[model samples]
Target: MNWNDLEKHFSSARLGRYRASCGGDEAKAATAYVNNMLLSEAMMPMLNVLEIALKNGIHRQLSTLYRRADWWEAWAGNPAFAWQTKEVVSAKAKLQRREETATTDKIVAELTFGFWSSLFNGSFQSVLWKDLRLVFPRCPKHQRQRHAISSALNQVRDLRNRVFHHEQLLWLTPSLLDLHTKGTEVIGWLDPKLVPWLARYDRLPASWDAFQPV
Candidate 1:
């Protein structure tokens, strides 16, 4: 298609508004950006599965450590732990509005990745990490400390949010492939079998290869 036709879809405002330095033919650059987004979309299903796995895995681990399903709620009384309190409050509100009865498992599942990721924040690093760190077997294998694992999860979380929000992924640092690998690795830490299970349906590798300019 010619420039005008391309602009009809990949409008300069849409394409150039965020990423101003797009090189080569503007149309081709926009096409590449669109293709990258399509690839990003394809990775979502695998990412969704990964998100659930991480959530459940961490929930189970923490529950076992605390020996209580409502363990997160205990932090509510602590004035210094406001962030953790907010997450617990949010989860409780979600459960109260559910038409179906909310089981502990369902309530835990409903919590956002941000909530789980928050457990790794420096504020809880001393208390929470002692128990939570035990769940991350793959971290030790990779020579990653708790901070490293937290950093990786936060990066993947950022990428996941960007993809879902329709934000630009092409400009992400460390490359999307690297980010996806970190996500898959985090999944493997939780459940070794889940890695191959996700691999069976993951379209990221091939889609990414296709997006590379021929």
Candidate 2:
């Protein structure tokens, strides 16, 4: 299809960055636009595995620390965890709306990635970090500080959001690659065994190599 057709279908606003990136070469812009989508598609599996590893790791640790499966219940009752409690309430409501019983597993599945990442924020550093830090068993003792883990989680979270939102990722190729590495590193920290399993399915590297000269 021609540039006009592409613009009409994708919207000029959406194609603006592509157009600019390719120096006004309509063909290149269209190629880049399609390539951007491919890159985004390639990223999903890695992000999916990373998020699952993170949430499950934290949940397992917290459960052991509290000696209960629904350890978030303790947080919900504590005034200091007001923000996290609000998220738990929202997750439960979402499950209820779906007519699914709000079991601990269901509630955990319903919670957003944002909710899980926010637990690493400074507000809960004192209360949750001590227990949460143990979630990363493979991470070196000296490198397992709350702030470092928080930064890594936030970076992956941002990249995940951008991909899910269908934002432009062509220009972010280098940084996106870095975040992908960081994400996989975090997964390894959670469980070294998971890295090889995740690598078996990951496609971002090949996708990036294909989108050369961008």
Candidate 3:
């Protein structure tokens, strides 16, 4: 299809960045648009593994620290963790709305990635980080601080949001590569064994390379 067909179907607003990036070359812009989608698709496995591992690692630590499988209940009762408590309540409510029993596992699965990542922010440092840090045992002691882990989690969370929302990633090729590396590193920090296992399915590198200018 030609540029007119592409723009009409995808909308000028959506394709604007691709057109600009391609120097007004309609063909190149169309190719870049499609390549952007391919790159987004390729990043999914890495994002999936990172999110699951991070959440499970956090859940494991919190459960052990609080001495209960449903450790979020402790947070719900604490005023300092009011915000996190709201997230937990919301997740449970969502599960109940689906007619699910809202079991601990169901509630955990219902929670958003944002909920898990938000736990690393400074606001929860005193209340959660003391024990939460154990989630990243594979990380070197020097680099295993709350701020560093928070930054990495937030960055990967943002990338995951963008990818899931079908946003343009062509303009962010370099940063996207860095985010991919950071995401995988976080996964390894959670469990070193997962890195080689994940490598077998990762495709973002090849997808990025395919769309390079030269």
Q: Pick the candidate with the highest lDDT.
A: 2
- lDDT, model 1: 0.75
Ordered from best to worst TM-score, the candidate numbers read 2, 3, 1
- Candidate 2: residue pairs that collide: none
Candidate that beats the other on TM-score, 2 or 3, i.e. the better one:
2
What do the candidate models score in CA lDDT, each in turn?
A: 0.75, 0.87, 0.86
Q: For each candidate, C-alpha RMSD in Å?
A: 2.8, 1.5, 1.6
Select the stronger candidate by lDDT from 1 and 3: 3
Which order, best to worst by lDDT?
2, 3, 1
C-alpha TM-scores of all predictions: 0.85, 0.94, 0.93
Displacement of the residue 23 alpha carbon in candidate 1, Å: 2.7
In TM-score terms, candidate 1 sits at 0.85
Model 1 C-alpha lDDT per residue in residues 3-93, reported as the tens digit of each score = 5676688676666643464554566666766786787787786689878877777787778877898777666678767876787667768
Q: Best TM-score goes to which candidate?
A: 2
Model 2 residue runs over 4 Å out of place are: none
Put down candidate 2 lDDT per residue, 1-214, tens digits, no spaces.
9889989999999998888878888789889989888999999989999888788888888889889999888776678888788998998888878899999888777788998989889988888899999889899888799899989898888899999999988677546788889999999999999989988999998888898535
**Residue pairs in candidate 3 whose N, alpha carbon or C atoms collide under 3 angstroms:** none
Off by over 4 Å in 3: none
> Which of 2 and 3 is ahead in lDDT?
2
